[model samples]
Target: MSQAVTLWIPGLLDALRVKEAQASLKDLKLPALQTLLAKADKFAVKPQSFYEQASFLFHQPGCLPIAVTKASAELDEFNPNHFWLSVDPVQMIPDRDTLVLVPGKALQITEQESKALLQKFNAHFAEDKVELIWASSQHWYLSIVQPVDIQTTDIEKLAYQSVNAFYPKGNAAQYWRQLLNETQMLFYTHPVNEARREQGWPEINSVWVWGEGKIEADKLLIRTDASIHSNHAYLQGMANLTQSHYCAEPESYQAWLNQIAGFSDPGNGEIDKHFICLDSVADKLDNLQLDEWLTLLQQLEENWFAPLLQALKRDEIDSLLLDLGQEYRAHLKPSHLNRFWRFKKPLNSL
Candidate 1:
């Protein structure tokens, strides 16, 4: 019989124990909560391999962090609801010992990677057990309990018949990738990394789950791969991008787009369509910050961007626009052609 032996080192165990899983952690508030699950781990296979070597989690109005939860929490003004904060029954982090989390994306890894993944994960994850109930690419939940003593084939059969199966196509896939990358970095250098590695544990290269509060071993729980701990360029960029945003004037652009055709919540089946429409048409206009672009709209009224601005203004969606205009006025300079961008381009290009 192949016996599964897990590594139990001091640094690793202590580090995992010192997590925000306890109820007392809620007192840390939003800023502190943001500090957990960093972007780079020193013990990673590669020195500076913080996963999200790309992208950012900007703090713009629409691009705020979206934390997942079962129900909405009337969080403090500062914390509020963030993109990283998901509030759905599908997402739940258990306060109890054992927990299960269905990732929102597909993660590919090998058997060896699986063991390393568990050790690396167990190191910083202050949990007793994780019955990582996973759904195969075919959308069938495989009842395989990780780090547990139970082996139930019947449960696996039942899961195959009933397990939330929804593919994370576009936006979700991107978010999941970012999350895993950041978590990998955090776990890499986490005190647990060296201890676990010494025990011959591999690394968690990739993985995915259906969603939050996934059932494992007849228990309900939630899990998220938000751990990140790194000072590398990519990690820094992820942090910055998650915090910064290009605020532009002329908010009516959004209202104007809404007033016209092609705007909707599109539901789950057509989420890709929703993002494409919003990103291509509406968000594109809202994200523009060039002073000349706004000027062109205000002056010519016949310029390419003029009609859109006029529509937004006519629809009375001027909150962000007004704010943008006010901020730009506070620090206007002839040299600054665009309030959002500083590129030296042709005036017509504006």
Candidate 2:
């Protein structure tokens, strides 16, 4: 039986901004990745958020049902009937004429802090028939009895960028914008922010509202046979929706191989398809930490790209699909590996 693997690597193609680091890339030996890119068939795709890309893979495209899908996975008793929106905590840095949105990952918000913050938010807006639900320290949800008509920008796109241009837009835009301002003011004086300030941590001063939608049973297009390996809540939720084999991502390619080797068959044929997301470089790329990004790339070269290339060569995997997020994808087979004449190119060239 032939097996195939698809890798979703978000920051794989981002350019290194630091001039000093450009030289370091030359020193980094990623021969396996270089060869795969050099010989594989490549194509362009419309730039999209990581959530959108994952949704596309699960056949739930267009304005992804991100909130409900993720809520279903996080919430103990998820009510698919209610409309959901991801009202995740964030910090807005005021810069001259704009506010730079810092995502929650940098905040390192504790569970106690999240619960305290949400308690205040939920009480303040309780009369509005909307409640803030704490899914995790980093993940929060807004449950609404009646869904509103507004489009939201995914927090990922707004991270480290000015929020002036990306504020929620649609017929109900003004309402959501007002709500955002109110929430910011509500959190401004909260003990959580006060404690965070004293600790030299970024304040969870506001919430970024996005991924507003309800999950419909008919909309769930599931492919149960394929295995999904990711640490992302949204993808894991999709796996649950599909009732597919889902597992947290392994530390490395070898670790993943070891995990699947122990799987027992339940009268079904061996699962030949796998989807893996390796997104560790995304935060480094977003924060412009060039050295860290290069280090991670080198690590991936050693742990994932190198092993995957060898797997393809040995026919352990018949084909490999590399989704190098935003615009570039590479498809490779064993024969492609034999294309030694296709000279390897520099990492940045892709």
Q: Which candidate is the best by lDDT?
A: 2
TM-score of each: 0.21, 0.85
The whole-model lDDT of each prediction reads 0.25, 0.81
Candidate 2: TM-score? Answer: 0.85
Q: Candidate 2 residues 87-203, lDDT tens each?
A: 998999999998999998878888999899999998998887568888899889987777789788888788899999889988989988998899999999998898888988888
lDDT of 2: 0.81
Question: What TM-score does prediction 1 earn?
Answer: 0.21
- Candidate 1 residues 1-350, lDDT tens each? 11111111111112222242333333323221111111111121111111211111111122111111111112222211222212111111233452234332222333444444444544544353322311122121212222212111111122213222332334345554454344556546654445546876533222333222211222211111111122222223223333221121223324323332222234312111000011122223334444432332343223212442332234322211110111010111112222333332221211
Q: What is the lDDT of residue 274 in candidate 1?
A: 9
How well does candidate 2 score on lDDT at residue 347? Answer: 61
Q: Which runs in model 2 stand beyond 4 Å of their true positions?
A: 17-22, 26-28, 57-60, 93-100, 193-203, 217-219, 267-270, 285-295, 325-327, 346-349
